[model samples]
Target: MEFGFARHMFVGALMCGAAAPALAQEANASGAATAASRADGGGIPDIVVTAQRRSQSLLSVPLAISALSDETLATKGISNSAALATAVPNLQVSSPYGSTQPNFSLRGISVANEFNANQASPVGVYIDDVYIAARTSHGMGLFDLDRVEVLRGPQGTLFGRNTTGGAINFITKGPKLKGTEGYLEAGYGNFDTFKVQGAVETTMVEDELGIRIAGNYEKGDGQFRNVAPGGRDPGGVDTWQGRASLRIRPGNGPLDIKIRAYAGQNRGTEAGIHGLEPFRTGLGFFEVNESRVGENQTDAWGVAANISLELSDAVTLTSITSYDGGKQNLQQSSDGAPIDVLNINWRSTFRQFSEEARLNYESDKLKLVGGVFYGWDRIVTDNSFYIGSVLAPGVDGGFFQHYRQTRRSYAAFLQGDYNLTDKLILTLGARYTADRGRYDDGYAYLFARSVTDPQTPIATTVPCAGAPGSCAYDPAAIFNLKGRNNALTGRVALSYTFDNGLLAYASYNRGYRSGAFNGGSYTSSSGINYVDPERVNAYELGLKGRALNNRMTFSAAGFYYDYTNQQVQDLRAGPVNILVNAPKAEVYGGEVEASLRIISALTLNASAGYLHARYKELALQGVNLAGNDLPFAPHWTAQAGIDWKIIDAGSDTVTFSPTINYFSRQYFSPFNSENAPGTGQINSELQQAGYAKVNASLIWVHDNLQLRGWINNAFNRKVYAYGLDLRGAGFPYNFLVPSTPRTYGVTARVSF
Candidate 1:
């Protein structure tokens, strides 16, 4: 995989906003709407958004954003950012480490691989003004959410740092305006998964103030096995979470405040897979009744504060401060089994503190926003291991390594919109950030094999140490790694418009993700410092408009991303894996969307995107691989949906919606396109060929009551979703992650 990373270069200048409202439509996974309309008003309802440090209509800002209505979230079964892919168009979701984390990409870009607080997500995620520093945190279930806005492209202006591919804002609902209300949801699905959720809101001080609390409990039998000769029930973990908030209006003053706190816990078995050969893999892949390895357990907690105040006649100031914490301890497993007994136990923890302040100034012809942000974080990880296969010693998984890191970051930005004419608008934005990072990593390894089966010996032709064929295994030895890194980065943009609904935009966005010591540092042989940051310069253009009596909406855009000092993972013979700054790359693509109200109660929406995604260049340590299609990146994707309101049952309304999506086959590994077994050859993923899936939902909304349910993967089509290479033999050793199966659930909410 090529890591398209860029180092740091700071640049900045204020471009005041004195223009008209921006032109863009926000779509959540479920419903669709361009303008907010109210029966009470002649046209659209005033959508008050804090996206620019001020509550404004969606169109007033020059940005590409998608919003998921509170009702839509309930229909799609999306509790956090992980479910965002179902409706947001160009978003892709995956969990590489396990179900415990959410790894995402907006337009084929993502964060560098690392499990620590020092590294920020490529696409930043924020909830109620407080930022979620790690991707894992994004997996937490959301409750009492009012709306979710997905901002596309660069949003460095007036936002906390780290958004290279845009940002996602999770806005929760405020105190009930008419009084007390709440909801509850419960369901059972495949994998013996059981889930329960509930939320309670109360008007503690009548019309003066209120409080809300929500929580979730989920458990299930995992899908992997632990193979140890006469094995036991390997690893499978279940988790739970809770959240609370307090909203205050304080005697009609110009200031209002909201405070929230949360906590979570998980306990289960650690079950990861490993390829034994070609046919099947995992704990039971070898047809074993059981395996010797054991599982791990985990738990964690945190808090946040958000405040809004009107300082004077035209200037409004807002402040947000938060602290997040997490911890996990597990007895893990690794890829490839040299066998003799190897046991790894790891404990990881994170602490992050951040503060942001912003002010918005509004006027008749121009509007502007500016903000300052500072963040401090630290992470500590401890690893313990015991191996008896190589048999050089018997500490039985003794203290193997201890890792610690500290990171501090700060940023300042401003944006302004100018209405040059009655119809023309201009927008400008800029941001500057400074970063400092440091870490300490210590690791070592001992020899030990899985006592029972003891790793099988390797059989291969030896070219005789000095010959050219291959090196044969002599006396087995343990492997280990120890490494470290640090860095910084910054961005700017400008856009213009005209009267005929045509718009043009240009932006310069810089992104960075710090390097880290791959666990490889545990081995005794090689000494590799760390992997460097992947950076990108993005340039783009597009158009947005309404047509046919405001019944149809359309938009089209193109973009080019230039990458520098990319990171590439290298897998040599044996179990030696390392990361290095390889050759550079360039990506080109365009996206288009169209929606029409076919009839009064029916509507049609569709989107298409093409990415001429190529490496442009892929040189390793100096070897040029100029024209390779970037690994795992698909060239094209398209989605379409239809929603119909069948009945407006007087006091209730019922709507049924169906959606279908398609993604061309993507490569599983860079070297394997022909689907070769041992030689790692697979021209392209055939089993995962471009396929389509259908999903539908039934919703019933009535006075004081809302009932919703959905059915997914309706056809039960089996598809190869994701896999990894364990050794040189292409199909010899690998692991597969399956897509979730069908599920159906009902949620009920009442407001009085």
Candidate 2:
């Protein structure tokens, strides 16, 4: 559970990757030259990525990155953003609130336990070069996607919005210029899960215009058996999504434009929660006793337009514009008991608009890219709490809060790479950003009335402590908080390429995250409403190479981060949650990824990540947890897999692949407590033990058709995704959200 072990393991992995080829075969110039020339002979296809805003080889990117292609995602059964955490190194994903709002962490940098609708996350999410500012919609389903790229460190230069932790880019397939193609897919699994998807694209006007359309629908029964008295289904999902695109090539010239529109709807029951004492009482893993099982409903839609003009072979201009909006309604029980002590209902809606323009120039000696970005968004949220059990008999009472906020941001950035020598390159990037945020209106009040009274509760919408009807709304009271700031961030890198396609690079980057208003009811208890920006300075060294006649690829990186003004969730006198700035923190880690083709029919893949994140100076309330690790940060994460083509027909093939992922024990809270003192009872019920799971899939492919049978979490291991301590809210125990159990399914697809 300590960082010392992780460090040692990381060094061992690096040594193994660096010396493997040398030890396996003697060094020879002729052999290295032959491998460098075999670009098409590989275990996996060459992955081209846009991590730096341009198409390039994945291995050539200077930053630490992990990529998943459409085929890879399907084979691995990764259908959403949250599942990506299990496949990538140094990454962890959780849904403390629900699956619609996922929280992500990379290299020990994360934002946990803060759910203010107006506060943005440090981890940036982008689709088709447009930023998604709300966490609620970041967990977009993966359908008809080309690939997904995860950049592990600071991305403050090109991606300027809140990118202190890093960025995730979801790239979807686009329309073909002169082709008529499509695909159909269907799947069935245990738990009554069913899915169907289809896509089509055609050239409406030969080489002048093209159109594409796609859609997906999925539904499944509850993974957990709800045993609550008189409770309905509590853990099921129903979702549908649709997309359309038009690609225009005017006069068959160099001017091209694409317009894309998409919409999605989700309606499902909330996740089930288990009490801490349930396990001790010999109950099932997911059994719960609750009188009220809440439901979740959401609607989201967006449109994006992209225009590209090739002024010359060496220069081009591009423009991107987008608008996105979403609304959500959710209600859930807080204590997970039949006699509910607290129930919460949350309603939220948000809208955003963004515009970006870029220019590019490239030549044999130098390449340049620059862009300007503007974004605006408005968010509104309402939270209502029903506390009937805590009030006097027949005296139903509760609290209500409502808030609205707006944010505007502008940024300009430029990045260029120049060849210093035939073997060395220098890269420089810089960006300047200005941000403004305002809390337009906020209101809160308490209401109490006798339940026996025939008349309903006459609750006022305005904030008032005096008698009823004597209340009024205020714009400048204590809630009209405004914040503005400017920041400059950049990146510097030096890379060298050898004649044998080997690359080594070192980089330094400064990252920034903007401040925002905390739109919540906490102001009534703690008088806190605003949070400050956070910053990070990072250094990295990396190496990438191909060997064994281009059949094997290897990569490794080591990084260090000096973080200041780190934002964290804190508890005040009323035990109310709020966002506060931590003085300082530090994180250092290393990771290695490798893929080897043992033979033309068999391949092996492996990756490992290590991190040691700690708060160098932190004081919360009266407790000082200076050396404690951040929540959700595990010391080590790793995965290994093998793909074997057991049978090969002239025009058909059958393959089997198995993968196993492992993670060290992780703490869900800064306290890092595991068990009650001098007892085996579960006291610090907010930690997950070290565990591993195995997954396997068998696939048959013939021409343009495929059939697959897969099983995930094969052994049905019991794991917890998140936890909460309910003792402070008059509950006698804690609660845990259980992870999905074993699932098996069959899928079929056809393409023409």
lDDT of 1 by residue, 1-752 (tens): 01111000000000001111132222221123335432132222334566766665554444566667776665555655566776665666654334455656677665332233234666778877777765556766666678888876655556676555678898877675347777776766555667777788888776568888888887776544334544443334377888888888777577778888888876755544343443244424312222444454545567887887988777788888999988767654443243524345666687889999888787766777778889887667666544442333442222244556666777777777666765555666666666666655433333223443333333111112221113333333323233333323333445554443434555555565545444433332343345665666777765554444344555556788776555555543433345555457677776665555666567676666566555665543233556655544556566667767888778989888777766665554443343323445333432255565667778787986766667676676544545554334222345444454454555454554
Q: Find the 10 residues in a row with the least total lDDT in model 2.
A: 449-458
lDDT of 2 by residue, 113-146 (tens): 5556566777888888889887778867789998
Candidate with top TM-score is 2
TM-score for all models, in order of appearance: 0.79, 0.92
For residue 225, what is the lDDT in candidate 1? Answer: 39
C-alpha lDDT of residue 404 in model 1: 64
